[model samples]
Target: MEPKREFFPKVKKTVMPRPYFATEKDVLGHRGTAAAVDAAIYGSNWYLDKEQGLIEIYDAGAAISFFNLLPRKDKYEKEGLYLRLKIAYRTTENANVNLRNFSGNHVTLPNSLTGAMYDDPQTYWWVTDDLTLNINSIFSGEKLWIQRVDWEWMSKEIIYEDELFAKNTILYRSLEEVQKLYSEKELTDDDVKDFLRDKIKNDDWFAKKCLVMLREEQLMGEKLVKLFEDSGLEL
Candidate 1:
């Protein structure tokens, strides 16, 4: 008897939707990461497209960090615009983060200015989450019309060293796990640290990675002291 052929299951991608949006101008402050994104999204271009919106950046290994956005408002913000535009990628896009870079439509957002993208409400996006594993990698698809939001993201210097570093070890988890652990309920500092510390002892690689994270500016002054205090580790 012949076996039945089945299609691959939809892959759940790890996407961080909370991002600070700025006109292609304000984001210029992060020239280094911005350039890398530009290269990944637009090949080798001396200038960013007027319609492009520089989204987020992860400066960990300086490996991959950037977003390409298409514009919607009447005028696009350039390098010298005294304009303030905030935006957020709405996560309520159907079932999951739709893949496929085909932002050529206009969508309405709640508060922030409206924008255009290469997406349609009726059609299912072709790009699957499997392509972008959410490990601070380059995302070069769908110029989205993200709505501006008024939220302060951690300083760009934050590096998110922990998030990136954790991937190599057993601590790595899909966004679903993150959502379950923290999103659904509250976790006390001690409880959180205790849980993770226990896992650390079980996973040697995870423990080693934590040490590296500490070395990367994570240990110093109060930060160093706090690590021990939080983990209930003496000295």
Candidate 2:
């Protein structure tokens, strides 16, 4: 006997109505999990575009972190400019964090002098729970825009070191410090440690790679902010 084909509804493009930010109250109303969201959304993809504007949610993070990390400059703060965030969404249980490129339409900045990314309504995600996610680039300027946010990310140093050293750590070498065994030859751990130390020290290329990783992490942070905003609560 042949099985019947299941019918599925066509996916539609979501439209964000009057409110752009989501508060914790919305989540309480909808009964959602913040942990799952933090893990899946912000912990994943985020980044910037080549055109000097933020791409998806992740891109927004990268841009903000980049701006924040740069030396204080006058023009970036004084210039009259605004950011347009293009948000896409889905309500299905199978829905994942997938922030696409900006729609090219920018959200106007609040009337004020010395604009900061974190100050813009478009860049912030406020939830009914009173939890707000602020996105800001550490640096400023159109020419230096392409530099990835991960380079300036503070947490990257520890996170990367932990992941890279996970298997070779002292804790994993046997909880007992079994080096007491006479049969064991010279420790091979020194070589691995030395190699990693040198890579972080002498190799300029390794430094660049670290920068990319930091920017990617920043991107993830932005996505989480977007998810909270899209949750449909007051921001």
- Whole-model lDDT values for every prediction: 0.35, 0.32
lDDT of 2 at 210: 82
RMSD, model 2, all Cα superposed?
26.4
Candidate 1 contains a number of clashing pairs equal to 11
In model 1, where is the ten-residue run with the lowest total lDDT? 124-133
The number of the candidate with the highest lDDT is 1
Model 2 stretches with alpha carbons more than 4 Å out: 1-187, 223-235
Clashes of each: 11, 31
In model 1, what is the error at residue 221, expressed in angstroms?
Answer: 35
Assess candidate 1 and give its lDDT: 0.35
lDDT of 2 by residue, 1-235 (tens): 8899887788688887776443212111111112212211232234334353433332134212212222222212222212222121212222222212222123322221222221223222211121222233221222111222111101111234557656432222352443344245565889889988899899999978888788876767677778578668775
The best candidate in terms of TM-score: 1
